[model samples]
Target: MEEYKKRIVKTIQFIDNNLDTELSLEKVAEIAAYSPFHFHRIFRMITDETVQNYITRKRIEKSAFYLALRKNLTVKDIYHQFGFSNHSAFNKTFKKYYGKSPSEFRKLAPENFHKIQNKESKNGQIDTVFDQYICNIENLLNWRNMNLKIKVTELQEMNLAAVMSLGIANVEPSYNILIDWAKTKRLFPKENVKMLSVYHDSFKVTPPDKVRIHACMLLDEPLKKQEGEVFPETIEAGKFIIGSGEVTLHDFEQCWVSLFLWMKENNYAVRKVFPFEIYHTNFKEHPEGKMLVDFCIPIH
Candidate 1:
């Protein structure tokens, strides 16, 4: 495994050295001395992305620097230089990876660059490299040490498909099962569905992993539960303070500890509902598995 990892690092360095060339998995596998057939699996296991995805991501990362630094180059020239055959292909891939087109990125480049630098270092900070490292550490501590208080409100009715589970450790499995069920039922929405993680754990003394979690959705009130008759639970709606951080479900205890501490420090009361998590993005997209989830706890 160490040998395979070293080979992957070397292959990635080669790709970095020759991003302008026509690179493919077969070629990369050859560089790594691994079979082309087994290359994708190795890449996925080691990097959590397919070889093609990795290449595209690297291309986008490099292009981001160019978008800021290179003014004379047209998007077309950029695409051609990056080995993308046409502008449209380049535009599509850029949008998919960066959520913005090349032209759009170029237009916003200067302002975005300054804004990012400033916002990232509003506190007395040195360079962006150090600022980012400090921010990450601060966020991690905040996610672990912040206390949370509970409040109540009346929630508007919603239509949703969900998986209901008792213990917090079951949250991940329940969430995956609900997603799978949504896929099987063809209920996954492209643009509108506000994926939610609702919680209701009355017993305060329960261990963090043993706390309950319900992977749910807030749907239009009129739609009824059809295939799976998970309970039509009502979530009281009101102004509830929520804190979010980038952490995995397996490390959820840290977040909970933070929330409890925050609540205690602030003199806020705790509600019975288990704090729920909404996974907005898994870090599978990045080489670093920096997964981010928002923990919504009903607080006073």
Candidate 2:
């Protein structure tokens, strides 16, 4: 798993460095040391788009940046800058995705253009083009309807030994302790352990490190008999309105945002300290289809 993660990071670096070139699946496969046939399948499975499709989407995304920031550059100039052979092909692809010509986009969709450019700019901390492309594609494919919601009523209280984090990035090591210690303590006894990660801060404002994630479990009674370091204080009991959605891995933020908006519209006041995720689908298991995360938001 660690090796695969390292390879994925290297692939991202390679793409960022060579976006101007023709990014071929065969070449990327070689970089990842996979056969061409298998690489295409894996790429789509991991990225939720064909290699060619991902490349084209990234090109268009970069074109959006040039359109907004380098206002003096002509449409043809921006097209060729992205290594498009001709302006017409560039216009065709852009229109296909955004529903407008380059000129129309510049004129009528200035805000969208600026938003893209600003997001891609330095200090913005926007993710790679591939991530953005995957997210947009997922949103187009899966939009939620409130009526489709499934309710889970009567969730009991939980006691957790936790270390809180805020605006923090890349704290996988810290959370490992929670998992490791819980096991050593035999917290779940005969019950199958359930892993829960709760996010307490909005990603938009909080730096990645500051995002609080409480890695915890639901315990059985025999385990609860043990006290002190063996058990932490009980997690407060509350009535929670649960809403869940399965989304492409890239579209996690959209799912979270949609759920938050739903709560807001329905007048549900969520406590900041208790946000949680029940991971129903592992990322490695289904790299393409959808990742299921069930959220429990306490309602007043």
User: Candidate 1, residues 260-281: lDDT per residue as tens digits?
Assistant: 4455456555443335655666
Model 2: residues with Cα > 4 Å off, grouped in runs? 1-142, 146-152, 166-168, 187-191, 221-234, 271-273, 285-291
Q: Could you give candidate 2's per-residue lDDT for residues 1-300 as a string of tens digits? A: 334433543454466457777777778878878788876776666445676776676577667645643566799888887779997898888866555577876674333321222123365443322123223433533564632263636677775554333234434554565566666766633344565666543343223532445455555533444221122325467767676777665665555555655665566555424567776655666757675677776655
How high is the CA lDDT of each candidate model? 0.57, 0.56
TM-score versus the correct structure, for each prediction: 0.42, 0.45
Off by over 4 Å in 1: 1-159, 202-204, 207-210, 221-223, 272-274
**Root-mean-square deviation of every model:** 20.6, 15.9
lDDT of 1 at 93: 77
Among the numbered candidates, top lDDT falls to: 1
Error of 1 at 296 (Å): 1.7
